[model samples]
Target: MEGISRTYPGRMHIAAMHPSTQEKSWMTALQHLKRKGAIMALAFLSTTTLVSAAEVTYERLLNPEPGNWLTNNRTYDGNRYSPLDEINRDTVKGLKVAFTVPLAPPSVGAGSFSSSLQGTPLVEDGIMYMSDGWGRVYRIDMTKGDRGFINWIMDPQTDPEFATGILNNRGVALYGNNIYSLSPDGAFIATDKETGEVKFRVETQQNPAEYFSMAPLAINGKIIIGPAGGDGPMRGRLEARDPETGDLIWTFYTVPGEGEAGHETWENNAWETGGSATWVTGSFNVARNELVWGIGQPYPAYSPKERPGDNLYSNSTVALDADTGKLKWHFQYTPNDSWDFDEVGSQQLYNAKVNGEDQLLLGHFGRNGFFYNLDGTNGAYVNGEQYVDRVTWTKGLDPKTGKPVEYTPNGGVQTYLPETRLDASVFTTEGADKSYCPFIEGGVNMFPTTYSPRTKLVYGLAIQGCAFNQAAIPEDEYLTGSVSAVDTATGKVAKRLDLTSAPKGGAFSTAGGLVFGTSANGDLYALDDETLERVWTFNVGTMIDAPPMTFQINGKQYIAVAVGPGGVGMNFEKYPARAKDENAKSMANFQQASTLYVFSL
Candidate 1:
């Protein structure tokens, strides 16, 4: 027995010596293998565990289905045009309030300026996702509720760095299975689109002082996010990351580095902190393979002496290669910017006839109060005209060079009267004017513009107002400016709706023969595309700044506005409201309800 055990183990081992037993054993093994195979199949179907995931491509990021708003400007042109015509001009009149999502700040306990719902929101497949300035995101089911219910909310207060309660997250970007939100501290976090669970957080910048205010623009499988500390020492930059793995792909600095073309434009290499940021969302030109963004003013904004020459990328609209952050071309709207007039609003891309030839055009109503038309392909100047009446710096812009000619303001430039520190309020425009609509403080900040495809016209709300007795501060403190829109074809004042003396929001246009915008007084109105006449108006009872978005759901059309107050225009001490709400706390604390109100017929 010992010998047998040594040779073949025990009786079970001997049983295998028989052919029938061996066959039985093989059958048992086959049965076990089948069970294992079944288990493997179940696992494959039950879990999404595959490491290889689909990348968020640029094409996918910018273009969503008919009803989906994929990026900030709806389409890359910053046109905010929706193909859905369910809410045409004829039907929009019948539009009634469909639902209102009261996006209250995450906590009243938190000390934050009461802001309105600033995200225009992207709605698709019965789901609405948006963010407030406080870095809170709400995913709501559009199909189920007469009033949208919050499916998930991610508040920035959960992040320690974002605890200051001052950061503003405008909105979020959605692609594949993830929803991406940028934090005020420059962290790009990806969350499950269905669950709102954070997948990963990529720090785009290290400075906490540099607030992350831009809505992330997903392009061609890359997540593009820029910084908002245009007021600080940090230079502005945008990063493209692999949406799937959160890996850095490329970075484009608004200010040039050493030994570069725009390097000489900065003082003492202070270009390191120059303020050319993409604060507002950018538009993508699919045909051009370019992502165009406008840079903010140079830092210490008021002074041009610290930063001389036309700061290469500052105060300019640049076209960059989407895949590789290469500058394809740029048009500097204000060179040697002395007034802090930044090119920091919407860069509306449209196709128009230039000199009787078809060309891709970009319309910019810069803070300098001039409307510009540039070649979208090469950033060539087609036309630039002064849309505002009170522009005292230069009488007109050189169409060829896109530079303003100082005929009258030869020595009329607003300068600092000594002893004035960097006081922002003292830096107002002091010039003579006729019907100056949007006041200087009410000038266009980082807002958006609307382009009309049917009229081949871009409808913009120009703030026509002037400033006087602006105390001169250091060059840096003086640069903050306003927003406006100029006609691309004529370089003529098609329309200028000044918001200087009031509460104004961004502009929106549609194919339905209408243009829409808001005021600090909570007045939302529609204008005739042809006449720029106010045709329809509604009082939502909130001051607003962010642009409005329109889309269709369940064969019904809706227009949504992101209502928020208190920024530049909300500086009640300066630009006081037409009538103050006595019931509100203090005028400074007169918070606009942060809510997304949807209207449909």
Candidate 2:
């Protein structure tokens, strides 16, 4: 009875039952095949004419309905904004937890690195499609607002010996009759959306250190996927595959090969293992026919001295021809970055009037501590500003070019504020604490940000503190959290909210005039879109790692977020505590579990 005995918060899990033998190696994958099989059997016995449900056609994805969250970002532009206003500010006060579905127990076996839920769930009609760390996709029937029924689950059955360690999958993609996702071990899987049967599985990992985590971006007939594990010695590349057969269509290597256009930017052959991981999903500029995606920093993180020159694609926003996977243009954010400034965050696409003319723009809250607004069509830098309070990386950005004032043109190794560089500290010989602004994880790294069309403000969960033992900061503001509301037009911060704990969990906005976010201390809260005031809050008593998403069913709107702290960095273990963060101390002791939560008003 131990397999399914892992009940919901109160009663026995309404899903299934299994013996203690199931939880040994990993959580027993107590398959609910019987229930799904019975449903199929009943369908055959019924004689009445039955109309097949709708399929996820390209046209529907191009124009998603307000009642359903069709994509991970809810739209191709990655605004993460929902137009449903049923649960406005006034009615939001009455919002309460509607249902909770516990996921498969995280594996802790021999090659496992503590699996967790870090991906956003997709909702269509009233069914929720999500996957666990082990690449087990679950089809949950959420037609009943009060509870959720696990209809079926498709386990990829990855090999335990060669199972990827970091089993975090960002999310899954939906196209036609299939649901797509990549296992941590690099198995690109296409599963039947209705029956939970895998249609095809393609091996994409070239080596053991080339796993995947990002959710595939499905556009029209192509599924876009990129390799991860870039922190190790592996070249990163993005591939376009046929959704039906999982065959490669084209490839775009993040690191330029020898004799390639940007290959000269890398010196000493550092481009081979250069890390420019595209581990997060990006935006698609439909009008421009460009797929705008953010890239990560180079390998040997925090030690740029090992790799000279300005890494071209790393720390950049590359606009690629969506149909051909050909790089059209690119804009590098951090040149020769030494602070682990991975720019794999949001590439939020929006339109705004610039100088009396409307222009398609790309807005991003850079991990290097700036809010940038670039031309979405050609990757041109329009404007940007520092969103975080303290930044010592450089004096400031150049007003005209948007590059750092200290940045040198055609320079191999850069020395931007010498004092802030990892001076002979840990990068050289032994170890020494070095001071730097915007702690190593960065202003925001891979966490989804929100762009509210109503307020014209891009909200980001920002860490407003520094690292190193010798840095000088006020007692109250040594290391803390912040919510930066940057104007989409000017790229300037309009309102900033400082919180007691780090707001690590991501956020999303709704036409209801609310911005829903989560804290590392296990808090889910809603803020007024304009004023940025906390209107509601609910603590699940466990840290949250994924962002909040919104959808509507039965003429009623719902708010959803995956909760659990199976990942690290929630507790400040690396940098010593300066001022006591609100939930830092206790959150370290909190139990880790995978559970999906839904809310309704």
The models' CA-based lDDT, in order, is 0.62, 0.77
Q: Candidate 1: minimum summed lDDT over ten consecutive residues — where?
A: 1-10
Across 458-490, the per-residue lDDT of candidate 2 in tens digits comes to 999987677554333345544567898988888
TM-score of 1: 0.79
Which structure among the candidates has the greatest TM-score? Answer: 2
TM-score of each model, in listed order = 0.79, 0.88
| lDDT for residue 551 in candidate 1, whole number 0-100 | 71
Task: Check candidate 2 and list the clashing pairs.
Answer: 1-19, 22-28, 309-412
Each prediction's RMSD to truth? 14.2, 7.0
Question: Model 2, stretches more than 4 Å misplaced?
Answer: 1-52, 109-112, 160-165, 423-431, 469-479, 570-583
